[model samples]
Target: MGSQKFAVLLCADDSDYVKKIYGGYFGVFVRMLEEEGETWDMFRVSNGQFPEDEKVGEYDGFVITGSCNDAHGNDLWICKLLNLLKKLNGMKKKVLGICFGHQILGRALGGKIGRASSGWDIGITNINLQPSKIFSSLKMPASLSIIECHRDEVWELPPKAEVMARSNKTGIEMFRYGDHFMGIQGHPEYTKDILFNLIDRLLHRDLIEESFAEEAKSKLEANEPDKEARKKLCIGFLKGRL
Candidate 1:
């Protein structure tokens, strides 16, 4: 095969702070996921930017990014995205979803998604991975630590989908639909600093309480996300090398 091409469908607007420091969320994701031989492009789906329907097959795989919007919302762009996801599924194209991406993908695949009953999970979380064949070659640990900052989650899996991982707070920390599509409920691309900034923003907007923010900050000070392991899983899956 020729060189692999990948796309990142960004579902969040770049904050002025993120844009100033990280060149935007797209840059952050590319830095984590891109390798020497592969090419990556970004579509700001939150801004209504999307790959043309006829151009969808040009990339080897696609990665969907986290968002502030609810996955269950019927916004025009979200509806269009669901249709695109359905198209991608029909083609068996590789797709990976993170955070909001995960919830939206679940809805697209006929699953149910809504506000998580467990409330907000806004700290480093250890998700228990099933010893499924998908991880046989990954050499992953029984539990993987990652950054979690979401209020919505997948409540039901689509037909034939399998739950790959779970955490105490969320039943579907990870899930897979066949070999081509996967969703992870945490931010593998996030550094602790990014999450910290997000927490502050959430608190400032009254989305989270000061006490909750303090607790999440303390947890961040103690544990680190296994980004390398998560990166391997993502890149390997996207490249069909797993």
Candidate 2:
């Protein structure tokens, strides 16, 4: 038991999608966690290739990233992964979910998720965190702009989940599951350059319309570079009573 490390499970569903969408930002996040004297590991659970039930307890914490697939989609791997998340939450392990991870957390807690109205893909946007003990350590802006590129949002929260943040465009932007789990609907790990790359890929793939892509590109470019602050917020939130 002494040799066991304080591990963090990175639940990755789509390799290509994460590479294309998150790209270098993922590395930045991992490095930030490492800098905090934590030993974390990523588990690429794409296409239902997660470990069997016996191996799940190896992790000390968990962080689920966004996926290209919708939470409501009939993906067996998604369901299984969410089930595992529920178990981790029940055990009161530290867990954080971002974007698609947020939606999956909601689903695992008996909440519902679905496509957004007008099928709008929220790019870089500002989110306001509600006053909570989870954010007391850091002085955050009343409204902070962050990277986001999701078409689905959580419509309802699970029984024990508490809404922690909100945005004008998306009602439920952040949530907390009991005490040990937190989820955000935006990518706090993204830097400006990485966001540019993601927008470029989306444009090249025709996943986003030309007009929206151009607008989003301009907005992200104009936004202030604040990755460090957001990363601090992430660390602070996790360090809070959990």
Candidate 3:
């Protein structure tokens, strides 16, 4: 429980809304996981920036963030991110991937990722846990409700990857690729306000129907995500507590 260092490979730029409201995604994530004597640094990988190779070993853990870009896309930055993840895996460093990050990790590790047949899945969803295969140190419930906002999902997991959690909307909601790496399709770092803003943006871009957006918002308002439970899950995994 001494000083610990962590890096966030942020895959998306701060939307104007996020910047003004939550101080950006970095702020959002740090608030969720930061503890005493801990350090958090960020790299905007979506903008083609990354930590230098020599600096990668300094952090105890790395977190990959969500993005608007498709995880399966062949963009230059995305390709570079994939390579970095491969290196992290090779080094056996603790790495947590969220949403787009999850798909990218799956794709990088020889898994199949594509747009979900169910299209976009937004709101709080309950995932069934494979308790036996999961780490016993984790005190998470058999069913977990999390904030979801994604169009793509992992179609097939990489070799040796274990499906730890699944939901009706997605076959692979959460997966663990060895002890050092994990990918979650939902946003554990997101609060209801963040999702609300995101819904507005999606509506403004005409990416989602107004009725669907309203319904999603209503559902989100009706229930709360298991945030503390999620925080415990992410922090425990990163810090070797679970």
Clashes of each: 0, 0, 0
Write down the TM-score of every candidate: 0.98, 0.86, 0.97
Ranking by TM-score: 1, 3, 2
Clashing pairs in 1: none
Write model 2 residue lDDT over 1-242, tens digit each, in one string: 33332343344533354466555335645755544445556566544555457766765666777777787876777778877877887778677788888888888888989998847655678888888765665766667777888889999986677898898888898998777778888888766666676677777888888888888887776776456767886675555432
Tens-digit lDDT string for candidate 3 (111-168): 9999999999999999888874444566667888999999999999866999988999
lDDT of 3 at 91: 94
lDDT of each: 0.93, 0.71, 0.91
For model 1, how many clashes?
A: 0
Better of 1 and 2 by lDDT: 1
Among these predictions, the greatest lDDT belongs to 1
TM-score top scorer:
1
Question: Which ranges in model 3 have alpha carbons more than 4 Å from their true place?
Answer: 133-135
Candidate 1 weakest ten by summed lDDT: 131-140
